[model samples]
Target: MSTKRRIATLIASTALLVGGTVTMGAGTAAADPNFTFKYSGTTSNGSFTVAVYNNGTYAGLAEWNADPVSGHPGDAMRAGDVLSDGWYVKAILLSPYRLATTQGHPATYLTPWKTGDLPEGQKVEMRVAISNGTTTYLSQYYTGHA
Candidate 1:
């Protein structure tokens, strides 16, 4: 083969290999959707509601199992409203491989009830409040990627 032709073929092969690697990495990242917060714990914290926010806009609230059949969890929020649900979500135990402390913690699986399709690495904040008619617990803030 001519030297120039051989060089061209090598360049083409390298490009193909690089492209294939990038595509495969993206697929792996997508498949392992990371949940930002896993809820857990038992307190007289009252009914729990969860809403997802991207930037300053309200994405939506989880319909949750309580209203899974109905498809709407009965309430929606505007840009600045405090988000809540009529009940508390179960908490999750972080993977043993993870460094998160498991002591007295409750874990809630959030993927089932979270608002919408959240792309990886988007900055998000979760606000949670527990209320029991006369008493309302303070809202807690958890910020991370989704």
Candidate 2:
């Protein structure tokens, strides 16, 4: 084969190999659709409510309490905290809590969630975190809809 032709063939073969590898890796690296419930708020010493709505109708509710921690009052819920039914809570913190911080991502294998227990196409009103009483902090809401 001519030298120029040989070099062109080699380059073409390398490109094909690299392209094939990338195509295979793309499938593995594809991210799964994320369904998460997340919220954050402040409270000195009070209780907060996490509520889920479906099609403008009330569906479920979960509550957490804020108590004193390190001389600062706060509340938090961890991942795998099962709400009523199959609702699970997962929190991805943006940063470490300072004090009086309450936050988490809540989702479930139920209605109003992808891969949820409930059927799809349900209109989720809002996932809201509210702090009330004397130690009321800012109320946070999860704006994502299912």
Q: Which candidate is the best by TM-score?
A: 1
Local accuracy by lDDT, each model: 0.27, 0.29
Clashing pairs in 2: 37-105, 37-106, 55-123, 109-116, 109-117, 110-116, 110-117, 110-118, 111-118
Backbone clashes under 3 angstroms, per model = 18, 9
Deviation of model 2 at 120, angstroms: 41
Candidate 1: global Cα-lDDT? Answer: 0.27
Model 2 lDDT-worst window of ten: 20-29
Evaluate residue 74 in candidate 1 and report its C-alpha lDDT on the 0 to 100 scale: 13
**C-alpha displacement of 132 in model 2, angstroms?**
30
State the lDDT of candidate 1 residue by residue for 96-136, as single tens digits: 11111112223232233323434444433333322222222
Can you write out model 2's per-residue Cα lDDT over 1-146, one digit (the tens) per residue?
Answer: 96434533553465566552111110112222112222333233333445433333343343333443554323332223323323233222211211221223343322221122212222222222222111111112322121
